[model samples]
Target chain A: MHAFYSPQLTISCREVQLPASESRHALQVLRLGVGDRILLLNGHGIRAEAVLDAVDNRRHSTTTCRILQADAAPQPQPHITLFIAPPKSKNIDAVIRTATELGAAAIVPVLCRFGVAKPDLDTIAHWTKTVIAAAKQSHNPWFPEIKAPAAFADVLEAADDHGFFGAVPEPADALPSPAALPVDDQRQTSLWIGPEGGFAPEELSALLAKGLQPLTVGQWILRVETAVPALLAVVLDRCQPHQRETAE
Target chain B: MHAFYSPQLTISCREVQLPASESRHALQVLRLGVGDRILLLNGHGIRAEAVLDAVDNRRHSTTTCRILQADAAPQPQPHITLFIAPPKSKNIDAVIRTATELGAAAIVPVLCRFGVAKPDLDTIAHWTKTVIAAAKQSHNPWFPEIKAPAAFADVLEAADDHGFFGAVPEPADALPSPAALPVDDQRQTSLWIGPEGGFAPEELSALLAKGLQPLTVGQWILRVETAVPALLAVVLDRCQPHQRETAE
Candidate 1:
């Protein structure tokens, strides 16, 4: 079934109206009409089966969907918090979407010493929309909390769990593969990926001082967008068994 | 130092002329003049340092560079062959680039029942160039051999090595995580990822009959571009220890 984002949807509400954008997609793009079944996600773990009750094709169309069933999805365990320095324009969207698909619990954009883009409020809003669209497409019930840009030091101070920073390690300091990292089921895990130029020396020192272990995903240097998903995949793979056990 | 693709480069060559595209990039984009040093790769494990001897600035400019040093990078171990059904226009470039960065030994475009695009000679040429550029950027000496699009059944018939196909497994038949898969250092590993619509029922049956284990990178569905890197990262992580041991 096709899924649509309906942020205000709740179990108590038997009827809901999809947002204008989503309504157009359901009506025009997907050709969904009255009595057509679809799934609805509120980005807060609530997923519902809904049938289109009324379709309005006006410029400001709002489709009313009647809820048939509602259920809460189990939240991802070993909650992953990704601290990333935003790359250039479209690449940031790629990072956000891929991170969402990989089940990141939250995404924090950190401002690093050598970071490329300084994201504005509008950019953050745009990214939030991107995350929501990705969540609906991937059937992810929970959407990652997209935090505003924060200073590297501020983010480091706020990080209180097991933290790993992505960097190409020097030969002598090569870290173990993610699979070999000690699995800690109790604590949440967070990954930090720097921008194209990488973290400056002082920033690296600050991360080390804050007890973030350095991680090398692969030998070759990766673009920021590529590294985000690559690192997340490795981290998620390491945390999968624990998640499965917890789910059981 | 910057790296440029020099497809015909050899160890015995004392001096070489850069391709038109590379020359334009070196002179106009990077503004490198005579006496500038750069690295060159032949996309076949040979990497060389070269000093620009003469640079022409005209539209059809070709720069001459003298080789200063040359070395062969060892090929990646447990060579990976990726058979992916081509996605839409630009995403095909992304798949090839990420596959190159992750050290795939060969990339074969397979035509599937649900595949969207039929790649022609020009598409293949474009994808090959994308791999070359990615190889240079990632400092990978071994460029994956890009093959013409082949029939899905033909690929299945030719597959003899250990094979894994990317698919979201049924809950009752969940496959082991890539990291948990038994490791065999002697055998080359191959992975097959279907197009956006996913493998048809018969295609999945054929893959399973040929003993290709189903593999899921994460819980959520992923786009083709995202899935390529995510899957590669997991596979490379599983293959890392053997690669390190081989390096030693």
Candidate 2:
């Protein structure tokens, strides 16, 4: 079913207007007309089946829908907050979108010493849109809270005991054992991924000082976009081993 | 350090010529000079440190490098072969690239009942480039074998008992249990993911009849690109829980 983002959607509301962008997409791109049924997402936990009721065509058109039914799903557990240095331009979008699809509870773009991209307000805004589209596409009920790009120092200040960073395994060193991770816990967990060149020594030291442990998926050094989903999958698996078997 | 793909690289080879594409990339894009040091990957398991010795700048310039030292890594275990019905144009590149980065042993493009994008020779050629580039970018010593797109029935016939397909779980059904998967085995494993609409019912039945199991990685219906890496990570984690702790 076609889906649209309607932040104000609620079960009690009889009618709702799709967000301006969503409305334009529905009319111009999807060519959805009145009387068509579509899914409305609130970026919260609301999923409402709504039928297009009115289309006011002018210089700026608006599409309104009547809600038939709505359901709220409790957010998934082990809320994961990802703190990552924004990768280069080509990868930033995929990174954000995939992280959302993987159900990251929040995403914090960090400006690191070795990082390439310094995301601006516009970049953040674009990422917000990417998150919304990803949520609708993946049918994720809960949208991740997207934070403004923060400095590395600021990120370290916010780091807590529940935080961990993806470590590149050393050849002579032992592999990161699964026992090192806290499993079967629903507490909010944080994952910090460094820039392409990786976090500087002082940055690593700072993260470690803040009680962030190191976790490694495997031997191969993966690009930022590749690492995000891979690491998230592993961490999520560890967080709720048995809960993911059934459909949400 | 800059890296290049040299398919014929071996430990005994004293000198090697960079492939035409690599030569152009090193010269035009990367701007590496005659004395620059680089790492050469054979796409098998050979990793060699080499120094550029000569730059034959003719119509098609060829770069010759002197092999300094070489090290060979054994191929990673639980070799995963991905049989995927290609997604739309935008996502296909990411799917192939991320699968290679996740250390898929081979990738087979399958034409499914609900699948879009019937890939031709040109697309296959482009995907081969994508795999090679991903291998080099991810610093993966081993390259995944890329095969020509095949029909669904042909893929089903080639699939073994070790195969599993991602199932969209029913809300009321019990979640997929980890115990259902065969863990800690080094044998080759196969993962088949359908197109955006997923496999038709009869196609699923055919797979089931062929002894392919259904595996669910949580409830979120992921995009093909996102699902590829997420499922690969989970399966790889299960394959050798302890083996991935250290770097190769």
Candidate 3:
């Protein structure tokens, strides 16, 4: 079934009108019309089943649907929040989309010593579309909240709960491995990834001083795009085994 | 250090001449001259440290280096071979790059009922560049072998060793979850990912009948690019805890 993001959707509402962009997509691209059943997401926990009730195709088209049933999915366990230093290119969009698909709780763009991207309010608004599209494609009810870009030091100061960063495999490293981080399903997990050249020595020291452990995936140096998904997948898998089994 | 792919590199060689492409990149892009040290990879297991000895920048530029030291990196443990149905778009290139970075043993593009890409000799040659580029960037000494495209049944018949495919989460599913797959670091591992929309019912049944187990990352349906890296990172982490610890 086709899915549309309706942030204002509430279980109490019987009728819903899709946003202008989504309405255009439904009518022109998907060719959806009256009487068609579709899924509606509130970008939180609510996923509602709805049937199209009206299609007002005028200068600015609108499509309204009648709610049939709304199911609220529990937030994913070991909720993951990604604090990443956005790359200097469009790869940040790919990173955001993948993070949403994998069910991250939030995304924070950090400005690091080597980082080049200076994301603003406009950037957050632009990335919000990418998150919604990925959630819709992956059929995920929850959307990751994108926050305003912050300084690296500010991110470190604000970080809370068991956090880990991808450590470049270097000899003489004394930091604890990811396996050493106790997996507590009840606690929120935070992942910090640096820019292309990775975190500087002082930045690393600051993170370690803040008690964030280091994790290594292999010997190779993975780019931000690859490292984010890889680390997110592994960390999420390890942290939520019990929840997954219970769901099964 | 700048790295170049020299498929024929051997430890026994005292001097080596780079391929035309590598020479052009080193001379023009990197602006390297005599006395500069670089790394050379054979795409199998050999990585050599070399110093530039001669630069013949005539009509056809040539770069020769004196081998300083050559080390053979042991192949990644729990050798992973990704037998994937190539997606219709450029995402296949991304898949190959990620697989190479994570140290897969080989990549075999399989033809399935829903698969759209018909990879020919030209396609294989094109993908090889992506593998080399990723390996060079990631500093991975080992490059995965890219084989000719094969039919779905042929892949099943030729498959040997413990295998797992990502299972779509569905109701009334009797298939075993990924956790059920026992970890054996000594065995070669194979992963099969279907194209967009997933495999047909018969294709899934055939895989199950052949004793291939199913793995699940999460409830969301991940695209091939995201799914491949996610599954690879998780499975590789689970399968080779011993090796990682030993390396550390």
Best by lDDT: 3
Residue A235 C-alpha lDDT in model 2: 74
lDDT of 1 by residue, A1-248 (tens): 89889988886779999999999999988888899999999998898999999988665378999999998877876588999988999899999999999889999999988888999999999999999889888888899999878998888888864767887644465344433344554347889998885788888788777767676655666887688888788777656774334223
lDDT of each: 0.81, 0.80, 0.83
lDDT of 1 at A163: 69
Model 2 chain A poorest ten-residue lDDT run: A239-248
What residue runs in model 3 are displaced by over 4 Å at the alpha carbon?
Answer: A171-174, A242-248, B242-248
For candidate 3, write residues A101-190 as lDDT tens digits: 888999989899988789877888889989999999988899999988889998788888477887786656776655544534335888
The top-ranked prediction according to TM-score is 3
- Candidate 2 residue spans exceeding 4 A from truth: A58-60, A169-180, A243-248, B58-60, B169-180, B184-186, B243-248
Which parts of model 1 have CA positions greater than 4 angstroms off? Answer: A169-179, A185-187, A242-248, B58-60, B169-179, B185-187, B242-248
Q: Provide the fnat value for model 3, as a fraction from 0 to 1.
A: 0.54
Candidate 1 structure quality by residue, lDDT tens digits, B1-248 = 89999977897888889999999999999999999999999989988999999888676378999999898877877588999999998888888888887788999999999999899999889888898899888888799999878899897798764767888634465444433344554347888999886898899888877777677766778988889888877767656774334223
Q: Tell me, what's the RMSD of every candidate?
A: 3.2, 3.4, 2.8
Clash pairs for candidate 1 = none
Interface root mean square deviation per prediction? 5.4, 5.5, 4.7
Estimated TM-score per prediction?
0.92, 0.91, 0.94
In candidate 3, list every pair of residues with a backbone clash: none
Q: Residue A104's C-alpha lDDT in candidate 2?
A: 92
